[model samples]
Target: MNGARGKRRFLLALCALAALLFGALGVWQVELPCQTLDLIERVDARVHAPSGPIPPRSSWPRINAKSDEYRHVLVRGRFLHDRETLVDALTERGAGFWVITPLRAAEGPILINRGFVPRGRASPSSREAGQVAGEVTVTGLLRLTEPGGRFLRPNDPAGNRWYSRDVAAIARARGLPGAAPFFIDADASANPGGLPVGGLTSYRLRKRLLDVALVIMTSPVTVPLTILGALLVRITMGAPVLFVQSRTGVSGQPFRMYKLRTMRPLAPSEALQATSAGDVRITRVGAWLRRFRIDELPQLLNVLKADMS
Candidate 1:
């Protein structure tokens, strides 16, 4: 009788622990959507805040994506019209070219995406009125360097065809070694003839009701499974269970992507190697998680946050 009573108590305690774990998981899942909305609101506020002076030369070394990206800034410089590069862009006004001109600022050369121009007026001569020769003041948002090309289309410097505004590559191609590490997206303030439309930065909604429905139906099973997978990764791979990587999102925007850590750290060159099913860097638990697609469960949070679809 005592043995059966002890067994009953043991089972009850196990059930209680499981309930608490799942309860906490459910609360976390609910908080995720709220947190995502809060983040978006905060970023929107930052992007629209009163304009500030451009960071000086000394501050350039310290500037980073987390602190300075999308910052509204005012800069005084002269446009190097001869060195401008036109990058292909698709905007609300339709397909166009981004007029990226090098501005000779006090600190160094700064690339200003003056704005977008329709294909018909892509040449500097076509929009000559807007091309101010002397000193000019530009108000715009500071954007980070977009390395590599956009998606599968790489920037062909030799062909003078650029799919993305890769600052360093553009500088190298234009022979402007002193160009700033970042670029500025000029504000909606009008150009001389209004040829290139400024102030066109806008975010479009990509989420649909069907997407929310799918998340709702699958989350119950996936959430707890994710927790279990996290625990397993912690025990097997040790610290840093989650790996975050910068990924290009819709409209060529950059966003962080999160996933379960699945491989051992490697040097930069080695890390670039392609991996297959039997890659040796993959952890034992990671291999199992990857096999069942359990590693991607955390990205559901990204989808909830509207960073991904």
Candidate 2:
């Protein structure tokens, strides 16, 4: 009787533990949407406001990311493209570099993220047609300076390989001592030759959070299915259970989409070619996953971070 009672207690304890975990998870999940909505409301108001003069130098010290970032502003200045820094960036077009140029204005010099340019077009001479010489009025969203590099990697100014747009670091390196602490992302206006593409930043973050919440709330079922499918792919396909490729999203923006690995990696020349009905690269297991629509399971995580609804 004691043994049976102990067994019953053990099962009850296990059930209680699971209930506790689920309760905690539910609370966190519920709070995330609320936080996301609050963030969107605050930022959307600032973004939709009319373009105004940039914060004066006196307010520079008080500038911060919380309230000031993403504010629309206008600056009239001459772009000093010669000292422009090309920071590595990954956009809808593909992996490329951002053209960070300093604009000489009356208030002071400020960095302007001109836009994304592929490696071949990164050279200033390549896009000389778009380089406006005289004082031009530029309007866009302001962004806080990124410091300490990205993803635990430090900015290598010595080698001219910058990972983040650290305002102070970039200014000191470019010899612009009084450069503004913030930079502006140029609007999606087409340049003469359309070399560096602008206006890639998405403001639809509200939809993004809801989309992610949808994915997370279904985690109990999706997570297990994903793990099972991944294991099956790994076992059948040797290695590389996931395939990543760049695809265009809403508003003609490029984003990397994810899916279960169902085929071999394509060669550079063959990348433009699409997979057909009887493509040899698609493995037997991959075909089954595709038939059951299991290959798309990985895309749910994309909704979590890629601002794709």
Candidate 3:
């Protein structure tokens, strides 16, 4: 009888442990969205408007990070047609190649991303299509030049395949001289057909700061409170206590972001849509999750996993 009692206790303990873990998972999922929102709010405040005379090469924001270097700068130089780097680039506006060319500015040879040209127009010959020539005044944010290459794929200098904006690598590859430490995002200028353009730089510090703030809020304390809330919802309801969906992150990368299950599952293979307050699909529990941001806690795990990139 004692042995049987002990066995029962062991099984109960195991069940309790399982319950604890799932409860924690659910809560963590809920807290993430709120945290991320906060982070982004904070980063947006300071990321734009430039940060003084631009930090030296060492202090510039690293690859995939922000830097104050892009503060307003003025440079007047002639475009050096000989060496140009066509980089694979995607912008808030669209996807295309950035025409990064050396400009023989009086200050030095600063790299310039002339603008976005579609796939067909990525070649130097495209410069003839509508090139900005002569001693032009270029004014815009100075983004710290990306060096080395992109994650995973190393830059191939031989065949002229570049994944990132590593200025040093480009200089080495093209055997160019006096390359500036940074690159300028040229401001919008007049062009024909009113398309395939440059100088459409939009500055928004408010949005970026919010993103950074949200990410930071997903720290330890807030995550626990979220888990407690998930436990209450689960005990009152039944199965399907969590919801997961895929989202596109930086660099067009996709990852599954979790939330408290807020909507009714459609046909098993159905696609998800953005949730609206008035949508009939949202459950009472899900509505609460959305309101208090209990549904977004799972993304903390994603951030920890480095999946946000």
| Superposition error at 50 for model 1 (Å) | 1.2
Q: Give the alpha carbon lDDT tens digit for every residue of 1-309 in model 1.
A: 999998688667756766898998788678865665554555566568998888988788788876787788899989999999999887667778999999999889999999899999997889889988899999988888888876567899999999989999999999998789999988889999886788765332213333554676687798887877877776577778898888865445567788998888767987779888699999888898999999999988777665566
Each prediction's RMSD over C-alphas, in Å, is 10.5, 8.1, 8.0
The reply for model 2, stretches above 4 Å from the true place, is: 1-16, 203-309
Better of 2 and 3 by TM-score: 2
Local accuracy by lDDT, each model: 0.81, 0.80, 0.63
Per-residue lDDT of candidate 3, residues 188-290 (tens digit): 7644433236664443233344344455554455556566656645654545666677776554446677666666665655545665658887767777777
| TM-score of candidate 2 on Cα atoms, chains taken together | 0.66
TM-score order, best first, reads: 2, 1, 3
Candidate 2 residue-wise lDDT, 121-186, digit = tens: 888888889887888988888999989676535799998988888989999999998999999988
Q: What overall lDDT, based on C-alpha atoms, would model 2 receive against the true structure? A: 0.80
Q: Residue 196 lDDT in model 1?
A: 72
Pairs in steric clash, model 1: none
Which sections of candidate 1 miss by over 4 Å?
Answer: 1-35, 202-309
